[model samples]
Target: MDIDVKTLRTFCEVIRTGSFTGAAHRLGYSQSSVTAQMRALERQAGAPLFHRLPNGVRLTPAGSTVRGYAVQVLGLVGEMEQALRGPEAHPQRLRLGLAPALAYGEQLARISRFGRRLLPGVQLALRVMCTAEIHTALRNGDLDGAFLLTARAPRRSRTPATAGGPDPTSVAGLARARTAVLAERACGTAAQPGRPTEVLVQELEFIPSTSASTRPATPCRQVAVADPDCPSQRWLPEFLRLRAGEPPESLELGSMDGVHATVQGGLGCAMLPSGLARSPYGAGLAPLPGVPRMQWTVSLLAARSREIRDTHREGLATALRLALEHAA
Candidate 1:
């Protein structure tokens, strides 16, 4: 059977949005074009795909099976395009995306300067966005690499690596990206002040259903967080759950800066990166103890494929480690 990628894409989009018109609008194709493409696809497959309906379309049995194949085909095409675009030579620019609130003040300055020193020819284009978005761009070939947060840290009690290189991971997936751990930091409690200097993780239970002595009764127990996609946002609240096992109240914010300001205002305490906790921004907040440590690893992700891999990756990773050390 013969089918074009565009036809398969149209089929998938129609299944996704459940309407030809919706898929056409989303894909910037006319209704006739989408209909013709679907017709072509169905002919190639020798089976009907979508059952036309009064409200929205539904996938036929054969279409359901083909939908899975369509997804895999499209995903592979994306991976191939992304992998082939990566080249070792002096790139137009090293587009590096990072999570927002990763570093501020002095640390941020050092990151930019270090990039210029290490990657001379390529312009350093640093943009701050959520880690998930950074990862997506990295996978899509829009970025050369990214620094994103990962929760794959050593189990609590601060165990050191036994030996060897990072427990070895294979780089396989649509991204075809190689990842290296740049730095590791645990999540620590940060608030305005007036809490115990050394409270166990369990002691956070005392927080909910009670007001801080300094803060308002209503907002005192709230937990501030970055985007929901963040590892810290997902793990911290669960780690610091109430004695009854219910998640505490939360105040969501778009950036870490907003979280800090909210905390300073006595609205809540947030789970901040331990490295940043030691920074000037986290000046006074005390780290809680005895928690099943939620350690976060800053990972350097570079696009990698058999044909072309970034040559400057190791040098850039080294520079990043040095900058992080200086910041710490």
Candidate 2:
């Protein structure tokens, strides 16, 4: 049977709020109207969806099943609405994501340049998050694009290099340069044949139960913190791998500042992006020899809509490219 989007929304709202009155208040609808909508949905499904108790309402088995589907449907519909509204109508809010530590230095300054020159009217929103959150935001249409440290795109196809040469309009120029070792002085430390010198690595603590694919593929000693829900924690392990191997012993810390302090104390080594580590405000830490080097690429993404004006799309692309170049 065909179920109306409105009816499903009303059903989901009632389930979410636990009562028709609560849903009505949240949706700005009259209590009677909300009840009618729920009743209509039940009739369409040919089942009593909710059991009305004296104090509240409980979802029946069928109602619970339908509610699950309704949430997905409503969420997609909301995303579609936002996607169709061009950047202009939406004030061109660019939701840019970056690896936690990499959000500092010239990289941030370059992004600011794009917002000021290319998209003067657009609102640029910067988010420092793990690779997983950035990917999930792009897939869900919450982010315009992101600069990631990986070689590949997590969701969309990679933009090709320019035909004649590297496209000046591409974001590749802004991609971080991978270098072997970053040190103030070159000291010759004779290479030992077999035993790999132990280096300190910092670990990011991510929320538990997150998808495995989103986690970095590296070995690390897990550390427990008061609030394990922080996103920076998830990225800590990967950042550590960029310079050293998994830490043997885990240290539970309260804040990011605390994590940095712990690393500075020489209690253990921590891995941080070059852009972040080399920032003016950075804690002075010497880069040890045999450290691994890596880089992340940032790109702008748009939907394939013929109706979207070419000038606007190209303008956005140019701004993003220039921003990356400035950062480089």
Candidate 2, superposed: residue stretches over 4 Å from native: 1-90, 105-110, 151-262, 279-283, 300-328
lDDT of 2: 0.45
lDDT of 2 by residue, 87-203 (tens): 556655555655444343334445555655765655555555554565555555565555433323112123332233222223222221111111101111335232111121122
Cα RMSD to native, each candidate? 18.9, 19.0
TM-score of each: 0.50, 0.37
lDDT over C-alpha atoms for residue 40 of model 1: 85
lDDT, candidate 1, at 241: 53
